[model samples]
Target: MDKINLSVTIAVITMFISLFLSFFLVTVKTEHKLSNRLFAFFLILNAIDISVNLGYFFDIPLNARVFISSIFFLQLPAFYLYVLSVCYADFKLKPKHLIHVSTFLIANLILLPRFYTVSLASKISFLKKSSSMLEIQFNHVLVHIQIILYLIAAFMILRKAKKIYLENYAGASMESLNWLFQFTVALSTFYFIALLKNIFKFTEYPDISESLKIGLFLFELIIIFWYLYKALNNPGLFRNIDSRLKLVADIVSEDKNSAQLIDSEKEYNEDLLKLKSYMMEKRPFLNPSLTIQDVSKDLKIPVRDLSVLINHKLEQHFYDFVNTYRIENAMDILRDVTKSKVTVLEILYEVGFNSKSSFNTAFKKHTGNTPTSYRKSL
Candidate 1:
């Protein structure tokens, strides 16, 4: 048996953390009840899957290890479902939920002959072969296809949800499912890295696969931190919001600071002025959930016009334009001696940024300094 490494020890700890949190969510009276259950399942599967991987470092029996291979296939499905449940407050899984997980089910059916039908020694051998079994070959293609399709679907769900949320969900306390968006992006990046690792191994790209193990380590950190952060700060994101979220309920108090309205020239130029004025006056950028539609409603301008103003005239997309304003706002606050007592995180929220990464990126992009250093300079 291989000696246990420090990395494996840390991973085991993270695995238990996920397990503990999953149990909490499973038992809690959460907001998004259905979504929370689904997310907890995601966490449980992931924790156990990692546990099984770590098992090889210890004294795990072969039969038990082989039996647990099925959990890996279930992970893709569980992750996809979690994303769906969180993004769609109204989402519920029915008997049809099986279809989303059908690949894992099918994988298990096909893999059964090797993992179960064989002796312990033979089962281990079968698992080691690169492409000797039909099931193994099918798994490669299936996993790649499944990942691409599900990632696209997940991103589409987020895109649509953001659009709809900004348009109608004024009282949601959160403008966008910001944490969930980061979660999706992080999930996608994780898969991409894993796929890359597979490609390197298949292609026998020298020591690339060994280097890619670092990628896997980074992915573990991403999942652990992302899950813990969201689980701590915004438990409601995982709650089964259902019809209870009163989509337009008493417009969550708009920033007392008020949103500015802009004016532009005729045609596209007119859009430019209108968007600029609205941006300046309304400061809609301060709303992390602020979207083109949200700005449209506030400015009484069409979404397309606002898009054109940002895309063509401003030479920036809506996201960048908004971040520009947010970064500038952060700078103003950071430079003020009166606000010196405010923490960086508090200022991030004050300027409509929900995440440190987003705040730091925008801050560094515009000011060429991180939030802390920028403030220190002033």
Candidate 2:
């Protein structure tokens, strides 16, 4: 094998190994259904991508051609599902969902015969003296269609993910969504480069195909490694690191005869109740900027501890918990004849929402009815 092919092979192997480790680590460490399932799906898709690369590297046989062609079509839909899982924080696999996936698969099946026939024709042309221009043109057109379909799927996923990020969600969830968006963008860019290289293949470019393949392999390697690192590590890695330092300090201080401070249960309970009463009376969730940090400062608690309290005791994330309060207030407003002069948008803004779209989305999600529909029903 040439240096370029050897390099591409090593890169593909590294990506496969990283993906394998990530699959195992995520399975062991993550309990989140959506994240775990998405990682598993990514592992499968990465395997398919690697197989396709391997076939090109080896100039493999007709069977390899067919296998690669089939797997090529699998990448985009798997990626779309992965993005959906990250955005929603839920991976509910239903028959309807499977049906949607199968539709994409069916499209792949339609394209497969054309791909294999064209690949076979190209191989035959290389062996025989006679090859038609039409055969090569057909192959080129099919590949372009495949690239376009992949791009369309990726774009749709990105659009949905962006919408989810703009909606009120926990910081971690938002970060995850952004990460997926950036990853998809990177993948799209690499694919775009491949499309360009394909367009220029007939030109007398110096080893451009080899260079483009190596670039793609490196891109895949970087993405796989980055994603694996993020997935394997704990979500609150920095927080855990800080907690360990604090624990060591506590231990050393005890040995040094340092003063011990104890929190008073009575005072803590009183403060907790006071905060709850204020929230109930004033309903600060109506403030669009209300966040765990805001509440932590107002209530004199550490932000992490407050997050723990909400997640564990309240059984909801900060955003959902806050929105519940806002929706309750909205419900009351909708019921009041005195508030009949208030517009839906006015009520949405009054209750701490910055955007009518966000308010409508939250209202529908919480109540299973849009604000306008709910008001009409009332």
Candidate 3:
């Protein structure tokens, strides 16, 4: 086999092994409905990617090349969909999404005839020789379009998912978001390399092709392993450890006398105080959905202790505490004569309220007046 074929063979093997392990881990550990479906979809995409590499390795027939190219064109959108599903459980696939998928499919169908007419060897030779400015520009345009679409989808879901996690599962949510952000960065790097490869092709700098391929392969392997490690080692990777500890303390407090639980409670309280102080400094409460769990993770405090401190010492529920800060910040914004001209909705969002309704309700509860009235009074 040629050097390129040999490298492709090794890359294909690595991807196949990673794919197999990923599937096994997902099947064994995934419990959430959306996560399971996303994993399944991820597996399918990986399968297609592997098949494309395999077909190329063997110098498959021109018809096989056409099939593989179609699959390749579909892979990016599938990957973005998988990312969305993993990050957002409530994300529903819509008709508009289907339309987007169909567009890529139809475009591939239109090009398939041309793809099949070219011999496999001749196609490879053409790819190596072609430096046509028009073709390069066309490919670059397609690459940018894919990148834009993927980014829009990934970022939209990430923003919503981050809020949901913070509000609903605060203590563990920070860790989850941290990991998610890292994953996104890694994926983005891979896409960037792909973009660069297309640019190099357009610019007739074919020497970078091998380097791009290697980088792409390495990045994919890293992503697959990172995901598999999280899946297998901590299926509940997103759960807050501090919160679980606090729950234990709470249950024990209920069964024991105040005196008996005093020392333990005191220790827990001290830790919780440290955590709260850290969060106060960070001011994550600026996020309307920020919760006790997120604060705990940010401060590295046990979730249970954070819960206990908020519930017992502060005498406020988690959501109430978060909204209190959000409202307080909103008040400051409302009172600023220079910036007070900003709309109520703008102030609401500026202070971390996700919706105008929540901001209005929280402001009314905190200050006994609507934001507009408060602004006018100011």
- Kindly list the per-residue Cα lDDT of model 3 for residues 161-208, writing each as its tens digit: 654443344233445556776777887787888778766755667768
State candidate 2's TM-score. Answer: 0.53
lDDT of 2 by residue, 200-269 (tens): 5556884787677677777767777776687656353211001111222233356347544234567556
Candidate 2 vs candidate 3: the TM-score winner is 3
Query: Where is the poorest 10-residue window by lDDT in model 2?
Result: 237-246
> Which runs in model 3 stand beyond 4 Å of their true positions?
1-6, 92-96, 112-140, 202-204, 238-378
Off by over 4 Å in 1: 1-4, 57-63, 128-130, 172-176, 203-207, 236-378
- Give one digit per residue, the lDDT tens place, for model 1 in 1-378: 122364476667778777887887788776667766876788888777777757756897775675465577777677778777776667777898888767777877786677767787888788788366788789888878888888788787666565444433322323336667777788888888878887787775835864665557657766877677767776544422233322221222221134422333556666667778878898887776665667778878765455545654565645667777788888888888898999999998988887677678778988899999988887
lDDT assessment of candidate 2 = 0.61
Among all candidates shown, the one with the greatest lDDT: 1
- Among all windows of 10 consecutive residues in model 3, the one with the lowest summed lDDT is 239-248
Q: Local error of candidate 1 at 212, Å?
A: 2.7
The best candidate by TM-score is: 1
Between 1 and 3, whose TM-score is larger? 1
